[model samples]
Target: MALWGGRFEKGVDAFTQEFGASLEDDKAMAQQDIRGSIAHATMLAKQGIISQEDCDAIVSGLKDISEQIADGTFEYDVNDEDIHMAVEKTLTNNIGKPGARLHTGRSRNDQVATDIRLYAKDLTRELLEGNVELRRTFIDVAEKNFGVVMPGYTHLQHAQPVLFSHHMLAYFWMFTRDYVRLTAAYEAADANPLGSAALAGTTYPLDRAYTTELLGFDHAIPNSMDAVSDRDYLLDLEYACAVSMMHLSRLCEEIVLWSSTEFGFITLSDSYSTGSSIMPQKKNPDFAELTRGKTGRVYGDLMALLTTMKSLPLAYNKDLQECKEGPADAAKTLLDCMAIASGMLSTMTVNADTMLDQAHKGFTAATDVADYLAKKGMPFREAHEVVGKLVLYCEKHNKGLEDLTADEFRSASPLFEDDIAQDLDPEGIARARTTYGGTGHDAVRAQLKEAKAALAADEAALPKAPESK
Candidate 1:
């Protein structure tokens, strides 16, 4: 029988019963549902809404069910509409009348809200820790490859020379912003909604704050109507996941390019790579490509929930049932992607000599040459035109900018001197970027220091992570 079947004359049709069931997704929150019930039972007894004997029985029954759930021995019937119904029916059958009393002054509307908030709290914590580890990997890679210079690109064209370490650490800041967004999502889920009871506040003298303390929530939600209806926290979490995936996709796109024969900047480790089925020589970066493709999946998860909650009325509705699966999928996907990225990057071999060789091509030293003419008392705009004409001369002669002699340089602007070769050196061009946050060696080291400090602060703010396999 359905939990709310007392008002209906007949049972629901079998197909509709099966179609409306949510046990598949709700099963993931079995422990959360049990925990919220225990807190509510204890609070009800304190407020004299239920006798002490009933409260004791409810707590004992719930704890035992929790054990059954942990060991995978608990049975879930196909007819069970949700985890709440499965648990309540079992509790009533075992402990009889007191078990029936477990739902006193409560509703599935508020109960499910509390369960999702608790579940989101745990999920966000693990994501924050995963973020910390991924950021640590970036710092490790940067410090290990500190002195190597590579081409820096604008519009995929080499525009300047930059330290490889600086390039890697640029991603560290993108993910640091992700950490902040996830933390906001966690805070949004920290409010307790248990005592809101369906849609209106309960009339049975329930102590909402007492339950909040028992459940470790920041506070009881002040507005009862808002408590059972809103799923904004889930949206926040899914949005955070989407943004993090976008950042991962960008890094993976670069990995695909760098591992190609055309660029030859890095090589994937065999364990993180795969072989093409028909081509024995093909060592494809399939994992990176997969991560990039899954980015759209997470974005879809975010949009699904946004569309679900867009026009719902002012109180609880069945539409809220559509909220759970999306955020849960997003968080798990992000955590798994972070783990894969850490392993893939940590094992890959960086081809430093090849990167430096490529850095010297494409007239990457052109900006430094232009600066040279400007520093020699020429207006910068006129110096830009002088450099443009010089590049054309090199193209006409089939030579590079570095291959031009001082006589050839002075032909464009008399400001050019024989000693300009130092400015034209690729490494010197990279080292000349000594400003804060620039790609110079010293600047990159300073960024590493600042990044480490930020990472340590974020780690300290989180609970100690559980040991991982």
Candidate 2:
């Protein structure tokens, strides 16, 4: 029978029951639901709402159910609707009246809100840890390729020369921002909502603070209606996932481009690469491409939930039941993508020689030449024009600025001197950018030190995993 079948004359239609059931998706939160119930049961006993013996029976029954779930021995029935109903039904059958007393002062409204918050908290911490690991991988790659020069791009056109370590640290900073957003999501979910039964304060003398402390929540939610109705924390988590996925997708796209024949800047590890079934010469960056493609799916998950919550009325409703799967799938997708990207980066072979080769092409030293003329006496705008004409002359003559003789440079700008040749070397050009946060050796070394310290601080600040009451 359905848990709410007291006044009904007949059973629900099978199709309706199956359609309304959430066990298939929500069972992922079964452990969280059990933990929430344990805390509530303990609180109920402390408040004299239930006898200590009954609380003991309920706690023992829930612990047994938790083991069954972990061991894959828990039987799920579609007729039970959701994980909460399934676990409660099984508990009632096993422990008799005490199990029935478990729901005395709470409703599924607040109960499910509590469960989802707990689940979000746990997943957010996991993502934070993964972000830190991925950042560490970035640091490793940066330190490994410390002084390698590469072409920095503006609109896919070579704009300047930069160290590869500088490029890697750029991503390190992006992920550091992602870590902050994920931490915010965790804080948003750290409130307890167990005492707000069915969208209103319950008649029972419930001590919400006891449950809050038992569950390791920072505080009990102050408003009853808001407690059961709020899903902003879940939104926060999914939003963090979406943004982080976008960042990963950008990195993956670069990996794909770099591994291609035209770029020839990187070669992915064989374990992370795939071979064509028909083409004997084909080695593909399939994992990077897949991670890039999965970015859209994570974005869609965020949008689907945002649209579902856009026009809903306050308090719990059936629509909220549709919210769990989106964030759950998004979190898992992002976590897997982070792991894959980290592995690909840690194992991939960087072609520093090839990068340096290409870094010298495309007149990547033009900016330095322009700056040379400006420093000598030319106004910056006039220096830019001179370099533009020089670039055109070099293209027409099929030569690079480095290929130009001092006399040839003097033909374009009288400011040119014999020292201008040194300015055209890609390594010198890259190393000359010594401003803080620049691609120069000192700047990147400073940034790397800061990144390592920031990562260590985050690891130290991450909260320990919450234990069951």
Candidate 3:
């Protein structure tokens, strides 16, 4: 018989049981469910609803079940429906009457909410740590490549020359914002909802505050109905995961582009690349491509949860059960992607020579030539037109601006002097951009220092996990 079966005369059909069971999906929350039960039983004892002896037995039985679950000795029955009922049934079987009292002043509605919140809090801490590690990897790669210049693009056309380190630091800031979102999600999940009972306050006297403290929650939920029905915390978590995955996808897209023979900016290590079954010479970035593809799965997870909660009424509903799997899958997918991407980045060989060779081929120094004329007292608009004509002439002759003589430069604009050739060098152009946050070497070093400090601060903010049992 099910835990709530006393009111029903007939057992549910097999199909119904299969459809309604959440045991497989929620088994991961067994530890959290046990922790919430222990706190609830203790609160019941403090409120005089259950005796101290009963609390002691309940806690002892729960601890034993926890150990069994951890050690793979616990037998899970399909009839149990979910981890909550499985643990409760096991407790009742072991401790008899006192185990029955463990549910006093509580309902599965509030209990499940509390369990999920606890689980979210722990997962949030984990993801925050992962984000910090990934960001550190980015910083390490950037610092190592500090002065390497690359062609900066607008609409896939070369617009300027930029330091490779500066380009990498842009991703650092994107992920740093992702860390902030994860922190906010953690705060949302930090409140205790255990004492809310089944959408209305419990009739028995209950010390909600004591349970809140025992479970390490910031506070108890203020209203039973809101507490039981709210899933905004889950939404917050999925949103964070979705946004973080988007950032990863963007990086993966760039990896795919950079590793191509056409770009030749990077080569993935053998461990991270795959060979074509038919084409012997092919080494494909399959992992990076897959990371880019899986980003849509995370977005679907977020949207699925949002749609599930859109029409529900004030209190707990069976539909909320559908919310669990999406966020769990999202979390797992993102963590795997982040770890693999970090490995790929840390191991892959950067083809600095190829990058440098291609850097100047796209006329990357054209802007510097224009800027040189603009600085020499020519109207900026006129300088831009003059450089446009000069670029046309160079293109007609299949020559670069760097191949032109100083006399040819002066013909375009007398403002161009003999030293104009120096201004056309890609490295010289990149170095002249010393403004803060620019692609200049000095600016990139300062950005790396700032990135390291940000990483350290994020590492410090993650909550320490409780000692494992």
Clashes (N, CA, C under 3 Å) per candidate? 0, 0, 0
Off by over 4 Å in 2: none
Query: What ranking emerges by TM-score with the best candidate at the front?
Result: 2, 3, 1
Give RMSD to native, each candidate: 2.3, 0.7, 1.3
Model 1 residue 353 CA deviation (Å) reads 0.5
On TM-score, the candidate that comes out on top is: 2
Per-residue lDDT of candidate 3, residues 1-469 (tens digit): 7889999999999889989999998898999999999888877888889999998999999999999999999999978899999999989999999998888888999999998998888888889889998999899889878788888888877778888888888999999999999999999998988888899887888888888888888888898999998989989999999999999998999899999988989999999999998999999999999999999999999999999999998898999999889988898888899998999989988888777777787788887888888888888888889999999999999998889988888888778888888887778888888888888887778888888988998898888765322
Model 1 scores a TM of 0.97
Candidate 2 or 1, higher TM-score: 2
Stretches of candidate 1 exceeding 4 Å from the true structure:
463-469
Alpha-carbon lDDT of model 3: 0.89
In Å, residue 42's CA in model 2 sits off its true spot by: 0.6
Over 4 Å off, model 3 = 466-469
Tens digits of lDDT, candidate 2, 15-123: 9988888888889899999999999999999989999999999999999999999999999875789999999999999999999999999999999999999999988
Q: Candidate 1's residue-wise lDDT over 117-137, tens digit each?
A: 988988999999999999999
